[model samples]
Target: MAEQPLLDVEQVSKSYGPRKALDGVSLQVGRGEFVALLGPNGAGKSTLFQLLSGLFVADGGSIRIGGLDLRTHMTAALARLGVVFQQPTLDLDLGVAANLRYHARLHGLGGRHARERIDAELARLGLAERAQEPARALSGGNRRKVELARALVHQPEVLLMDEATVGLDFASRRQLLDDVHALVASRGVGVLWASHLVDEAEGADRVVVLHLGHVLFTGTPAELVAHCGAADLAAAFLQLTAGGGRHAA
Candidate 1:
């Protein structure tokens, strides 16, 4: 039998009173795959992220992470996911190691094991020396790296990044993307990266174009451009999201 997908979002739907934020969206990410969630500002990407992270319950449909149903087994499902939200969650007052340690403890990791994981992640991200520095003292790129390290300290099989490169400089963004790609390549971690930047999705294994709470396209970057009859990903994204004045959910 074929193995189950690492992350499966099946016909997931959500509504806010009169507005339908997501309507029957379905997608899957296999182990070691990097799937880019491409959409405009109001294309319900954030809503979907919220649902996946269990921040807000889906009004309809189901989500399964590592073959565990989110609704029926929230803890088990969540335990398999490592999430980095758009907003920075690190406590600026705390040292980088402290912040990571706190997250590890939340996931039942501590003492020697936690320290080993923390040390490894910090070194991998090139933040080893900064481990003792306050989170606020680091540059934007380093702080973002800290968040990524903390997310992986639990050694999750799936990673969810919601606009993770936002507010970063060009170099920082590129480095972050390279880091994520390395994670997928080396660790076999399935990743669902949500972003509005077409450049970020250029090399993704697959791209799911979401618009106005609906999926407009799902294929490779080349396929997306071909489907839209555009020359490149940016042009294709503009063409796909055009003619819609939809507000984000």
Candidate 2:
């Protein structure tokens, strides 16, 4: 039998009053694989992220992380997830090390071990020298890097990034992508990256195009273009989502 994927969502559904946010959404991310969740604003990406992060309960379907059911084994399933939200979650008043230290404590890492991990992540992100500086003092790109570092302090097996490059410039966005790609290659960390940017999804192992709360397509970027008979991913995406109607919240 084939090994189970590290992250799996099957027939997941969610709704807010009369509006359905997600309808039978399903996808999988294998170990070290990068799957991009491509969609427009209000395309249910945020809703799915909320469910995956345990902030919102799914009305139906199943989510498995590392073979643990998210609903039945919430703690175990959550332990395997690392998330970087689109909005920055850091306290600007706190020093970089202090922020990371708090995250470490939350994950039950403290004292020497926590320090070691913090040092290692900061060094990996080239932010070791700025450890003592307040978070507000850092550049946007570096702050995002800190957030990414914070998310991985617990050494989760899978990473969920919800439009993590939203406010970043071209260089910063590319750097963040490269950094996450390296993590996948070197640490075998599975990633489910949600974004509306076609360029961001270009290098993904697979792309799941979501429109109007449904998955319109799932395949490699090149395949999506070819399947749509378009010139490139951007054109393909435009053609696929055209007249699909405004995304449902």
TM-score of each: 0.96, 0.96
lDDT of 1 by residue, 35-72 (tens): 99999999999999999999999999999999999999
Clashes of each: 1, 0
Q: After superposition, how far is residue 114 of candidate 2 from its true place, in Å?
A: 0.9
Give the runs in model 2 whose Cα sits over 4 Å from its true position: 245-249
> Looking at candidate 1, what is the lDDT of residue 238?
94
Model 1 lDDT vs. the true structure? 0.93
lDDT of each: 0.93, 0.92
For model 2, how does the per-residue alpha-carbon lDDT over 155-180 read when each residue is reduced to its tens digit?
Answer: 99989999999899999999999999
TM-score of model 2 (CA atoms)? 0.96
Error of 1 at 50 (Å): 0.6
